[model samples]
Target: MIQLHSGSVMLQGGVPAPIPAAGSGRDKTMAYQILRRHHRGPWEGQLHLTFDSLISHDITYVGIIQTAKASGLREFPVPYVLTNCHNSLCAVGGTINEDDHAFGLSAAVKYGGNYVPANQAVIHQYAREMMAGCGRMILGSDSHTRYGALGTMGVGEGGPEIVKQLLRNTYDIAAPQVVLVWLTGTPPHGVGPHDVAIALCGAVYGNGFAKNKILEFAGPGVAHLPMDYRIGIDVMTTETACLSSIWQTDDAVAEYLTIHGRPEAYTRLAPEEGACYDAMISIDLSRLEPMAALPFHPSEAVTLRELLHDPGDYLRQVEQRAAEQFGGKATLSLTDQVVDGKLVVQQGIIAGCAGGMYDNIAEAAAILSGGDVGCGPFSLSVYPPSIPVNLELMQNGVQQALLEAGVLFKPCFCGPCFGAGDVPANNALSVRHTTRNFPSREGSKPGDGQLSGVLLMDARSIAATARNHGVVTSAAEVDYPAPAPVRRTFDGGVYGRRVYFGYGKARPEAPLHYGPNIAEWPAIPPLGEELLLQVASVLRDPVTTTDELIPSGETSSYRSNPLKLASFALSRRDPDYVPRARATQALEEARRSGAIPPELQSVQKALSIPDMGRVQIGSVLFANKPGDGSAREQAASCQRVLGGCANLCYEFATKRYRSNCVNWGMLPFTLAEGTDFPGCPGDFLYVPQVREKVTRGDEEFPALLLTDSGIHALTLYLKNTTAEERELLLTGCLMNHYAAQNAAENRR
Candidate 1:
C-alpha cells in the first residue's frame, strides 16, 4: 500500500520522475513557495521565517506569556490565540486551571491577543476554523499543529519559537528537504483517515523516511478525500517526525474555508510542474485496511485482519515490548484479552482533533444508530472537536441518535487525547481514535503497578467494535446503511458568546491575576568557562518521547511552576532521575556558594583544578534518540530547572526538541556514529572553555569522560547552530538573553 523512494525525484507532468536533477538551484516545492513568502532572511541556503500568526494552549500559554513578560514584552506583534483545552477540566489543580484560563483572558486583553474559553474548542480545531489560510504560515506550541489540508503550512514547535515571533525574532533553520506524498486511488467505505495515517506512520516512522522534512500531499487521491478526511491524515504527519506538511488545494479546500466563514482565505496551492523532491512516498489509498497501532507507539501498527489472524503471537510481542519498556515494573497482558480466539476491548473512545471531527462523529453515530453498546465493561464516548461541530451534530440529529444508542456525548475537550479523561481499568484494553497510543499515555501509572493498554483505531471501527459488545470487529464487515451526508452549518454565535476576541485591542492597564500555584522561573546562570556534567540518566531506548521526559495528563497541571514540574521529569521512565538530578543540582548550588560537595572532591582532584569555583557543575542525560513526541517546552525546561546542562544523544528525533534544548540553554551534544560513550550515571564529563567555543561557532569540542577507573577522551559535536542560538546558549536561555538585552537597552 505504500512505497518509499530515497532519491531526488522531479515532478514532471504531475508525476514523480526518478532521475537525478541536472540543475544547480534548489527545486522549489510547494512548501518552499509558502516558506519563501514568509522568509525574512535573504533567499539562500537557510531560511529565517516569521510566521503570519502564532498559537498556544492553556497548558503552554501561561508559561509562554510569563517568559515574554519577563523579557519586556509590550504587546503581541501578531495574532496570538490562546485556547484553554488541555487544562480545561479544572479538576486536578484546585482552581489553578481556571486561574490560568482567567490569566489567559487577561493576557489576551493586556497583550492584544485572542482567547478561546474552556470547552469552546481545542487549539488546532480553532486554528483551523479561524487562523489557517492558503499560502500562509503558522507557528504553534503544540506538535500536532498541522493545518496543511487547508493549504496552510503549520509548524509546531516549542514555546520559545513563538516567543521569538512575539519579540519579532526570526525562526532560523537550514533549508528542509521536501518529500512528495503522491496519493492515488480512492479509499473504500469503512476506511477512515486514521487508517491511512497509521499505515503511513508504520511505513515511514521507524526508518525515518521523512524526518525533519516537509510532506507535500499531491495527486488524484487528494481530490477524493473530504476536507476533514485530509485533516485527519495531515495531523498525524507529526507522528512521522516531519517538520511541516502541506496539501495541494482544490475546490474542496476552498469550500471548507468558505463554509468556515473565511472565503478570502481560500487559494489554490500546488507544486510547479517541474518541482523536485528529495524523497517520495506513494500511497494507494484504496488498498488501505482497518488498522490499529498497539501500545508503546503509533508506528507499531498492523492491519486489524492481520492482528486477528494471529492474535496470540502479535499480543505476545506487545507483552514483551511492554516488559522491556517498563523494566518489569508493571504487567501488561494483551494476550489475556483474547478469549476463545477473539479479542475483546473494555473501552472505546473517539475524541480530540484527530477523531472528533463532524464527519467522524456523524459516521460513528450512524454505525451505532439503533444498536446499543452492550452492558458489560465496554462503554463508548464521543467528543466533538468544537462547539460549532457539536451544534451541527445536534442539528443533524446525530447527537440524539448517539444518545439514544447509549453512547455518551461529551463537550469539546482534549482530555481523552492525552490521558486526562476516560481512562480504562487496570489490565483493561481500550480502543481509541485518538492521536497516540504510547505506553502510560492513557493515565496508567506503571511504576505504581497499575497499567492499561491503548490501541489506536478509527471512529468507525471503534463504533463497530462497540456494536459487537467489546469484541474486536472491523467496520467494513458490518452491514449498515450509510447515513445521508449532513450539510454543516457553522454557529459563530457559540464562539462569540464564550470566546474573548481581544486581538488588536490591548488593555495595558488590565491587572493580571495570578494563582498561588503559578510561580516565576528560577534564576539560571549563564554558561561558564569550564563545565563538569554528571551523567544523571542514560536511556538506551531507540526513541524516547517527550511524554517520558516530563509526562502529560495530571503532571501538566504544574507546568506554570518550574520546580514542582521538574520533580516529575522522567518519573515514569526513570524513577530515580529526579532525585539524581536534584542531587546534582544541590552539588552545583554548593559550588556556586564557594563549597564543593565531598562527592565531587575526587573529580576536582582528578581534573587538577584546585579552585572548583572556575568550573560549573550540572547534570547530563544520554539517550540513543530523544524528543520524539510533544512540542511542549517543559520537556527541556524541566530538565533545565533540574540543573540539566547537556543532552548527549546519537541523534535528535525532531527539530522542535533540539530547538527546545537550545532555547533552554542546554548543550545539545551529539557523538559521532559508532563512537562509544564510556560513561554512566554518577560519572563526570568535563569540557573546558565551552562558552568561548560555543560563541566562536566551533562545532567540535574535545571532552574528557571521567570514570572511577580512569579518564577517557571523547569528541562531541554541536552542529547547525545559528548565531542567535549561540547567544541564547551563552546567555543561559532565551528569557535570560532577552532580559539582559532589555536591561542594556534601559541603560542606553
Candidate 2:
C-alpha cells in the first residue's frame, strides 16, 4: 500500500520525479514557505521559529504556565488556548483534577489566554475549529498536534517549548528535511483513513523513512478525500515519527474554514513547480485494506483479514510480546481470546482526535443502522471530538442511531487515548480507533500484576466488530451502505457561550488561583566541574516510550506537583526506579551539604579527586532508544526531580524527547553507533570536568565505567547542541537560564 523512496525527488508537472540535486528547490516546498515566514533567526543551517499561536491541555498547561511564571513572564506574547480534556475526569484525585480546571480558568483570565471547559472540546478539535489557518504554524504541548490537512502546520513539543513561546523565545532546530507523501488512487469502500495511516506507519516508522521530516502531502489522491477523512489520516502522522505535516489545500479546505465561520483563514497552499523533497512516500490508497495494529504499538500493523485468517498465531505473538515487555511482572493472554478460530474482543472504542471526527462517526453509525451490539460482555463507546461535532451528529440522526444500536455516547474527552476512560477488564482485549495502542494505554498497572491489551482499528472495522458482538470482524466482510454526506454545521455558539477568550486583554493585577495540590518548582543547582552518575535503570527494549518512563493514567493527576509525580517515575516498567533514584538523590543532597557520602568516597579515592565540592552526584538511565511516545515533559522532569542528571541511549526516538532532556538540564548522552552499553543498575560512570566540556561545545566525552569488575573506558557523545541549549545545561534548566537573564537585565 505504501512505497518509500530514499533518494531526493522533485515536483515535476505536479508529480514527484527523481531529482539529481536536493538543495535549491527546498525553498519551493509548502513546508519551507511556511517555515520561512515564521523563522526569526538567520537561516545559515538552523531554524529559530516563533509560532503564530500556542495550545495546551490541563495536564500540561499548569506546569507550562508555572515555568513561565518562574521565568518572569508578564503576559502571553501570542494567542494561547488551554483546554481541560485530559484531566477532566476528576475521579482519580479528589478535588485535584477540578482544582486544575479552576487553575486553568484562572490562569487564562490572569494571563490573557483562552480556556475551553471540560467535556466541551478536545485540544486538537478546538484548534481545528478555531485556531488553524492557512500558512500558519501552531505549537502545542501534545504530541498529536497536527493540523496539516487544514493547510496549517502544527508542531507538538514538551511544555518547556510552549513556555519558550510564552516568554517570546524562539524554537531552535536545524532545518528539517521535507518528505513528500504523494498519494494516488482513491480508497476502497471498507477502507477508512486509519487503514491508510496504519499502512503508512508500518511501512515507514520501522525504517525511519519519515523520521523528523515534515511530510508534504500532494498528488492526485488528495482530491478524493473529504476534510474529515484527510484530518483523520493527518492526525495519525505522529505515529510515523515525523516532525510535522502539511498538505496542498483545495476548495474543500476553504469550505471547511468557511463552515467554521473563518472564511478568511482559507488560502490555497500548494508546492511550487520543482519543489524538492529529500525523500518521497508513494501511497496507493486503493490498495489499502481494513487494518488493525496489534498490542504495544501503532507500527505493529496487520490487515484484519490476515489476522482473522490465522487469529491464533497473531494473538500468540501479541502474548509473547507482552511477556517480553512486562518481564513476568504481569501476564497477558490474548490467545485465550480466540474462540472457534475467531478472535474476540471485549470492548470497542471510537474516540479522540483521530477517530472522533464527523466522517468516521457518521459512517460507523451507518454501518450499525439496523444492527445492535449484542447483550454480551462486549460493549461499544463513542466520544465526539467536540461538542460542535456531537451537535452535528445529533442533528444528522447519527448519534441517535448509534445510541439505539447500544453504542454509548460520551462527552468530549481524551481519556480513552491515554488510558483514563473505558479501561478494559484485566486480561481482556479492546479494539479501539484511538491514536495509540501502546503498552501503558491499556490502563492496567502491570506492576500491580494486572494487565490488558488494546488493538487499534479503524472506526468502520470497530463498528463491524461491535455488530458481531466483538468477534474481531473486518468492515470489508460486512455489506453496508455508505452514509450520505451531510452539510457540516459548526456551532460557534457552543464555544462562545462557555469558552473564556481573554486574548490581548491581559489582567496583570489578577491573582493566579492556587489550590493545595498546586506547588512551586524546587530549586535546582547548576552543573558542577565533575559529574558522578549511578545507573538507576537499564532498559534493553528496542525503544522505551515516555509512558514507561512516567506512566499516564492516575499519575497524570499529579503533574502539577513535581515531587508527587516523580514518585511514579518508571513505576510501570521498573518499580524500583524511584527508590533507586531517590537513594542517589540523597547522596547528592549530602554532597550539596559539603560532605561526601561513604558510597561515593571510594569513587573519589579511585579517581584521585582532591576536592569533593567540585563533584556532583546524580542518577542516570540507559535505554536502547528512549522517548518514543508522548510530548509530556514529565518523562524527563520526573527523572530530574528524583536526581537524574543524564540519559545514556544509542539514540532518541524523537527530537522532542531529546529537547525535553536538555531543557530540564539532564545531559542527553548518546553512545556511538554499534556501541554496546553493558552498564546496569549499581554501576558508576565518572566524567571529569563535565561542566567545562559542555560549555566548550565538545561533542565527545571520555568517561570511566566503574563496575564491580573494574574500571572500563567509555565514550559518550553530545551532538548538535545549540548555544542556548548549552547555557540551559550550564544554568541547570530553562527556568534557571531565564531567571539569570532577567536578573542580568535588572542589573543593567
Candidate 3:
C-alpha cells in the first residue's frame, strides 16, 4: 500500500509521506538553485563543467587510474577516494583481484589520492556518509554518482569522463532543461523507496520524461522524508533516464549531516520565489502500490497484487521477452519455474549501491530477523555496502540476526552486480535487490548454455518472499516492530592501518607499472574517401545497453588492458563480433602499413580493386537503439580498435554514447525512417571529408561508395560540442588533439 500525499512530502523512516506546508505554486529546489548559481553556459545545447570534485569506488578506481596513467596523468588535482568494497571476495579472479588492490594502493600513493581498501564501504554509501555537501558538483565513474538527495549536484559518467576530470578538463554538455518533479502528497504504508523509484521509472522511462534534463524534486512532498530514504529514491533517479536530480534540503538533511559527524557540510537550501520548469511530473504518494519490475528492464513494472493474482499471463509475456532478448535462442525459460500455481524462486540476494543501504537492510532484517530460511535449495545472501557498514551492522546485531535467519552475510563486493557471486543454477530463478537485471548479469551465460534469469525487487519484498519460502510476497504485508539501530562510528583505523592516503600529498615522480596485457591503442587511419563495412553485427533490438556490448565479466580483467578488452567486444550478443571485427582490423592495419592480410585478397579480387595493400576498410555496426547503460567509453573505444568507423543506428539510446562516438573520432550516423540500407556484412559505407564536416559542423553528409554497397549519403549531426571535443574529433582523438594543442602552444 503506497500512496502519495497532496501537501508537503516527507519520509518517515523508509516510507515517504506528506508534511504540511504553506501552498506555493512554484519554488526553486536546492539542486536547481545550485545548478543555476553555477550556470556557465546557455550555449543553447552546450554546458561546460570543471567539476567541483571527482569520486570513484573500488571497482572503478583501478580502471580510471589505469586510463589516467596511460594518458600521462601525474597526480589528482582534487579530492579522490578509491574504495575497495567491490572486490572484497578476493577468491575469484585469483591474484588479479589482489593485484588490482595492490595497484590501487600504489596509484593512490603515486597520484596523491585517498585509498579506502576493500570492505571499507560501498561507493555511493560512503559518499553519502562522508563526501556529499550542499551546493557542490561531483563526477563519478559509476552510473549512480547522484547525491541530489543530499543537496549536492552529482553525475555518473564513463571512466573517460573521470579521466578528463583528472586531467583538469571540463565535462562539456548542453544546458539541460530543469524539470520540477512536484511531489504533493505523502505515500501510504508498505511502500519503500524502491516503490517510488519503480513508479517514477514507469511514468518517465519509455517516454524519456527526464532525459538529459535536470530533475528538481520539489513541492511539499520532499520535506517529509528521512535522509537515507530520500537518498535511496534519489540514487535510483538515473533509471528514470534523468540527467541529474536534487531536492529541497530541510532540518532532516541537516540532522543527517550532523548525525554522520559532518555537520559543517550541511547548508539550508531553497528555490527562488518562482522557479521555471520546462515540464512537471507531480507524483501522488498515496497512489503507489507494491510494485514489481519484471525481467529484462525496469520499465516493465506492475503492481505485485496484480501480478500475483494471475502470474501465468505476465510470466508468459516475460518468457517471450526473454526469447527475444536471447534472439529466439530459447536459452532461458521463465514459465517453467511455475509449480503448484506459484512462481518458485531459488535464490535471494540483497546487494549493491541500491539494496545495501542502511535503512533497507535494517528494515529487511526486522522482517526476517528471527525466521529461518529452511534449507530446501533456497539460499539467502546479504552484502552490506562497506566494511564500516558491515562492522556497524555486526556491532548492532543486524548481522547476527541475519546469520541466525540462515542468511549468508558476505563482505562488500560488486560480484553479484556483475555476475561474480551467488550464481544461480541453470534453469533457476533468482530475485535480487540490486541496480539491474539485464541478461547474463546473474552469472548465467546464455552463450555458454547456462540458463537463469533475475527479477528485480526491493530488499524488503525479497525478504518477505524469502520468509514465505520463495513464493512471491510483499514485505509490506509482514508485521514487525523494528528496534533502534545501535549506531556505530566509522572505524577509519582500518583504512589508516592497512590502506594508503595521499590527501594533499602528490608524487608525480613515481612511475606507473603497466602489465603485459596493457597495450596502447592502435593507430587509427584517417577518414576514408569511401566507406565499406560488412554490417558485422546487426542488432534490431529497440535498445542495446553497454553491458551487452563489451560484457562486464570476461572483460573486467582487461579493463586496465584496453587492447586485451577490445577482443571481447560484443562477446555476449554476437560471439562472432570479435572475429568479424578482427578481420576488419586486419584491413585497417594493412592499409596503414601497406601489408594486407590474406583476407583482403578476396575483396580486391571481387571488386577488381588493386591489391596494392593500401585500401581502407572502415568497419560497420548497426543497432536499432544502442548505448543505454554505463558511461563506459570502451563501448565506443573498443569498436574503434576493431576497425569500426561509424555506427548506423535508427536512434542512440543516450546522449552519453553519442558523446563517446564524437570523442572517439567515430561518425555518429543515423538514417531516416523506412530508409532501407543495403549495406550488409562484406560491404562498407565510407564517409568523405568526415573530419572536415565534423570540424565545420555539417548538417548533412554524403557517403562515398567504396565496397559492394553503393555509396549513399545519410544525415548525421552532433550535439553541442565544446571546442575541445571538436578538436579531438578533427584530430582523430584526444591523444592527437593534445599533441596538436601542445605543438601549437609550443610554436606560439
Which structure among the candidates has the greatest lDDT?
Answer: 2
Instruction: Give the Å error, residue 458, model 3.
Output: 1.1
- Pitting candidate 1 against candidate 3, the one with the higher lDDT is 1
Q: The CA-based lDDT of model 3 is what? A: 0.72
Off by more than 4 A, model 1: 22-28
Clashing pairs in 1: none
Q: Candidate 3: where are CA atoms >4 Å away? A: 1-29, 36-45, 70-72, 87-89, 328-330, 482-499, 513-519, 524-531, 595-616, 704-722, 746-748
Clashes of 2: 0
Candidate 2 lDDT by residue in tens digits, 1-748: 8888999998888878997778889999999999999999678879999999999999999999999999999988899999989998897899999999899888888889999999999999999999999999999999999999999999999999999999999999999999999999999988999998888889999888888999999999999999989999999999999999999999999999999999999999999998999999999998889999988899999999899999899988888988888899889988899998889999999999999999999989888989999999999999999999999999999999999999999989999999899989999999999999998776888988889999999999999999998899888888999998677899999999999999999898898888888988888778889898999999999999999999998788998999999999999999999999999999888988877777788888876667888888899999999999899999999999888999999999999999999999999999998987778798889888899999999999999888877788889999989899999999999999999999999999
Q: RMSD (Cα, Å) of candidate 2? A: 0.8
TM-score of each: 0.98, 0.99, 0.91
lDDT of 2: 0.92
lDDT by residue (128-188, candidate 1, tens digit) is: 9989999999999999999999999999999999999999989999988888999999988
lDDT of every model, 2 decimals = 0.90, 0.92, 0.72
Residue-wise C-alpha lDDT for candidate 3, range 1-748, written one tens digit per residue = 2222323433334233344542232225454456546556563445567677777764566667765665667789888878776556666555566677777777777889877777767778777777788888888877778899888888888776788788777787766666667776676666777777877877777877678777777768787666666887888888777778888788888877887777898887766554445666778776776677887777778888787778789888877777787875446667777787887789999987888877778877888866867778888899888776777777777888888888898777777877778988987888887777777766677777776878778888888888877887886677877557555466646545765668679887765554454455666555554444556787877888888887875457666566777888888788888788887777776666776666666655554554333345767788888888776678888888777877888777887787777667776778766776655555655454555666677656665433454445555445455666666666665555555555787799
